[model samples]
Target: MKTDLYLDMDHLLLLLLLSSGLQAEGSLNQTDFVRLVDGNSLCSGRLEVKSDQSNQSWSSVCEDDFDQQDAEVVCRELGCGAPSVLQGALYGEGEAPMWTKEFQCGGNESALLDCRSSGSDRNTCSPGRAVGLTCSEPVRLVGGDSRCAGTLELKHEGEWRPVGESVDEWTLEEADFACRELDCGSAVSVRRQESSDRSVWSISYDCVQSGSLRECAASDNSSHWLNLTCSDFVRLVDGNSLCSGRLEVKSDQSNQRWSSVCEDDFDQQDAEVVCRELGCGAPSVLQGALYGEGEAPMWTKEFQCGGDESALLDCRSSGSDRNTCSPGRAVGLTCSEPESFRLMGGDSRCAGTLELKHEGEWRPVFDDYPFWILEEADIACRELYCGSAVSMRREESSHRSVWSISYDCVQYGSLRGCAASSYSSTILLSIICSGLLLQPKISASSSMDGVSEAKQQGLLVFRGSDFTVSCSIQPQYPGGSFELRFTSSTSAHTYTQPAVNHSAHFLFPAAEPAHQGSYSCVYHVHVFSHDFSSESRQLSLIVVDPRSDQIINNPSKIIITVVVLILLVSTASYFYFKQKDVTVPPTVGSVDLQHVQSW
Candidate 1:
């Protein structure tokens, strides 16, 4: 009983054992001994204290340096057993117990504790910083607390409230800061401060659901919400918005249909709900739809479009509205578009015609009708603003109605062509065309000039180009042959030139200085084809006498020179006659010479 012996299962075990019984027992049995160690050459294995594993487990100064000491201290404070008395960590020797040190919530010299749950956060030092709930003392919160997920009521003047009505997104930062500053664990409940007469700028916002306040609105305008710029989007019309926590829902109409409000977006939502209740959600395609939104009123077949950019087209065609097209002719098809669509005035057969459905008949809105009906029809066709048709309906015996127009829509031209029509209808109808209406619509058109506008400058102009002057639409000029008359105060009176080219520039010779005053060359434009001549722009040439004012009296110089020559000739002739016995000749000269000499 005093000696112990055992078999060596492995060679290493045999090598480790002693042969003698007492010696082997001493070698294998547990030994009770105490080893004192200095700070140097300490074995890596954890050294645990064999005392109450409280603060006293280690030297007060060495306590922070040992994991076992930390664990012992933490376990004791957490109501665990003595450090060495309890089973080591989990197993006796191999296990290294987990040591979690806690740091205080706030202090000038405190470490930030990584936390998980509320309990763990308060007691343990986690590896990662985890966000969780925190509660304020006294439990006075009515709306919410630091739960991070639950509702938090914000109280102003001792009244608790929910977060949404005045909440945008920034509620957490502002309210949380205020609450924590005020020592309320967190501002879980955020409510704007309200007043009996609230200024548009005074109401605060709360966004409990979103991550941030700016995220509630667009990034461009997030500050408005933070700054509480409610008035920027609101107005006080004889009263206030959200009076006594009740918002007003007023009713109005758009396109002759009732809606909750005038604003398109707001009213549209209300419209869907309201119209749905009235069993008028959206009309189905009766025939089909063809609408257009361009610079002018026109029809296009597009069934899958219902947008503000385009008018809702209600269209149908009967059999007769096919290839036979005329300006004021009736076709057996019709399309209902928006209000702003109008049939522009032009002389086009298929393209410019407007056909509306009256009594199941597609009638063209010609230039003859009251002009308003075709405009209204255009609106019905385009679902745009309604402008009166400039040309519609035919007084011709055929009594046809044509509705072809264009609109220059200024409001949405950047998105699409800007066109306008002023029409309204209680109900909208899609297009219904006759079998004859199978003819394709006229292709997109240019202006009435019938020329490519981009390439051609202005209208059909012939500047400095020759044009034969032959009469067609107009009667032959007076006596048939064209006459070019030149007139001016200085030029010949009514100087008539013959019939010439109808071009902008003329082949006529240059005018004399006398003819330069207000002399204009006007060619008749229409006169080339017709008897009535449209006058071309007057081409006037101004004659400027660059030097006439500077020539100082040339006529007097010529007269003086002639007088000097005559006197010299007379003097020479008198001297010769006196030598040749011309006393008689000298006598006459002497009478005038004597008076000069004697005087």
Candidate 2:
């Protein structure tokens, strides 16, 4: 009986292996039914689906019947990533027969043939309406925060391996192709990474020509790997401008999906990462459903990020998955667009010649009018996070290309939002902000005591000593005034002096109790036809009395005298009780005995 059981078990195992082999073969054969033809790569072209009837025939899918759901299944069946771009006649007009019935794919099917079909037949396909699809290549950047940056890896031979090549073989062109294939904008930089003994797939120049990294020849002898950083991975959509819109993040190396982040799962830190990833300035506003909830799926994970993370995915996430969100729960963010306009060649960020960065090149700005006014400069200052504008000047330099800003458009929105064009001008617009003034410095010196540098702590001075408080500032502007402000529990006082060489002195002939208070220096400057001011940190002053110190220092003598008094009192009380006990007892007893006998 045992021998029979062993033989039966061996037979069952062989049957199971054969079944698995047949299933694998069937899957492979199904891929042959669909092909992307006459395109740059196998993953992108005019999509053609073959029928499974007795007489098999290939036909192009109608654009009307093919939706994103159907495209998802087709791309998956072709062993490619998700669909990236869908258009009509993207490759070329298909020459094959048009498909009749429409495909109703549920988006999770293993193959296009497995999906349901419409009952009715729509036979005609219009010109320039043939469905053309471009699926994302099976390429990714891993071990980084966003999809645009990290170690470059490709799906080759049914496995993912880092791309390895010699240092001199790789260039920006190859990196640009990879970035574009991944839909990561453009290539910013590329670096070679050395690794320990491991497996890698190296490519040659054929990768750019063929538009497919998988089809390129590979080398296993390379020890250097490719690391890339793309320009962007996250974007804001459906808003007024590029800096304000609904937040979408593309993540995960296996299936790249740009999903909207829920407002509940995102915070200021996450917004910061998104803004930085898009090359924008700090986040200005974060609201729910401000830009309208998009059709993308809600993010399944909650990002727990420190504010300083380079990428949103680099931050840690909560263990629990969050797949559901209430209506209007999608996050909408607004970031300041600082990449376009900047101040240069000035002492501070708020004061300089206004320049605009376009196409990665900085050019000086020229107003639509011949001169810039205070109102336009005020708007520019506010955009730069500088205070209100103080003054505007036009300096004539060598003539060059400049970005002309429409004065009317900038009055309403950012300079970047305004329509700009290249213009030749010799004048450069420069402006100073009210926030450009430097903080003043405060110091104290006394005739009786030595000089003390400016400090936040209290300053000590003896009574009847002469002291001076000096206020100074860095020489940036020509002239300014210093106001020495003093505040005490009972009263307050203000002293003003014209700044001489950016310094002012206030003398106190006698150190009084009223002088002990918080003192500060406010520097006031008038330039560019506007008044600007900056106040220094508070300097606390403390007054002391010499007699009081002497009294407190002699406390030990007072304590010893009190101790002697206490001892004398206790000794006297003890002796008086002892003397009374001997004499009063005898006198009282003699008188009491006589009186008791008489009673």
Candidate 3:
């Protein structure tokens, strides 16, 4: 009886110890033991740490002892993407006690406490030195060709799931938030795709008080998913400004890898897309390793952009894959910066009073030569991402300090780069551009599938399949003609159609190998007494023989098929022999009975 009682007491003590240990672990996990406070977002605030699991006392880390490596671990622990900014007292000084030890983090730790630390340096920290951090939001877009255009997904509870909401519930505000979170600029369009009920995360704009989607709720089953497209995705790096650098592309947001494109694989069309996506004027220079080779991995596939894509990732890639590139083969591009020159006080950006930004100040330009305004207006219009100058006029203004721009020097570069000096002039030159025409959209509809606008991998159709290429433009003009341009290695042909209801469809009853080529749409309209034309990005079509799929060309598939057939035959033979043995009666000398029973 005494033994039994002692054993019961030991078990009770073990249970108590385990219960307390579990409680401590639960508390540590619940609080993450670290937090950012007094900032606009959960990812940006004063950094506080709670090391002791036995108590809830929290302390702040001194910026003197903390560095970027330490900040990385904290951001990872908080489920943020990365640390973008780190400073002292950026949010505010916290009231908690200072952490005395210096954190020796290697920047790859999963949690802050997982890293090593130095001995205690001090008990009290100086004023206004509390660590403040701002981490990039953990948001991404998936299931699209590029990072900027895709189905919206957010990281929650260590898992990535698509956002779920009614189609009508989402607005431009929500879309813009998602685009900005991915660093893809502002939103241009949003689409809803209804699918079978599935588990997904739902975010409420109001609940996003911290600007973190972590606070959002997850729904068990939702049928609606959001697809968003942003205005820009490509960015330049390692050069003079945002307009020039080695090209790095973020095709997939899941891994967050920005890969460098090979110069041999990138072409002028691809350069055009990169410049346009960055909101620059045009491609001024493109060369191999011009800016400098990057440390990131080289992109596996070559970009075949149509030159009109809003983002680089929206372009198609080569079918053959090659990961290796020769040294100094990475593409470097330079785009003309368009931010310095603008036309203000006009109906649109294209039509406005010319203003030149010189030496950090925007000043009205007074053409020193009268013909300079008429001859060089095209230069200003092109820099502003508009067509050639259609008309120019002089507006009378009060005598004010203005820039006397030299048009002779403007032909070399932007108007701001021209020779200019301060001058008092009473005339401000204004110009109008051919901005009434919008780019026409080109889409292909096949018998096998529906219409698609941006086929990144290009469209593949079986031989003899029916397909139609359609062209449509936005409702800006009443009448315009659509020109379908087709180009191949051997030949080029164009088909024209009258635009009805602002759209035209070119039907092909049977697809042939000759039809395999690139197609684009050119919209031509006469408006404002000027002939204006805008072209859509190219669309690639491939006509393939369906019978090619029936042949088993892969050696692995052949081996797998032969192995499966052999296994099937062997199993059948074993069963057949066993049944025959059972039917036959056992004879005296037949040791087969024992052998069969063992088998």
The top-ranked prediction according to TM-score is 2
Comparing 1 with 3 on lDDT, the higher-scoring candidate is 3
Which lDDT value does model 2 have at 105?
78
Each prediction's whole-model lDDT (CA): 0.24, 0.74, 0.71
Query: For model 2, how does the per-residue alpha-carbon lDDT over 226-292 read when each residue is reduced to its tens digit?
Result: 8887756566767655467898877553445577889999999989987776557799999999999
- How well is each residue in 1-599 modelled by candidate 1, as lDDT tens digits? 11232222321242345333334432322111111122111111123321112222321111222233333333222222212211111212322232322222212211111111111212332322221111121112232232222332333222333333332223223444333322322222232333233212212332322222212221121122121111111111111111110111211111111111111112232222222221121322211111111111111111222223111112121232122222322111121221222222222221233444322234443321123344343433333222222323333334323322222211111101111111222222122111111111111111222222221111211122221111111222233222333455545433333443321212323223443322223323221132223232222222222233211222333443444455467777777887888674633342232111110
Candidate 3: regions farther than 4 A off:
1-27, 30-32, 51-55, 123-128, 205-211, 231-599
Candidate 2: TM-score?
A: 0.50
Candidate 3 C-alpha RMSD relative to the actual structure: 28.2
Rank order (by lDDT, best first)? 2, 3, 1
Ranking by TM-score: 2, 3, 1
- Model 1's lDDT to the true fold? 0.24
Q: What digit string (tens of lDDT, one per residue) describes model 3 on residues 355-415? A: 8765457888888763475558887877677878998888899849887666655654445
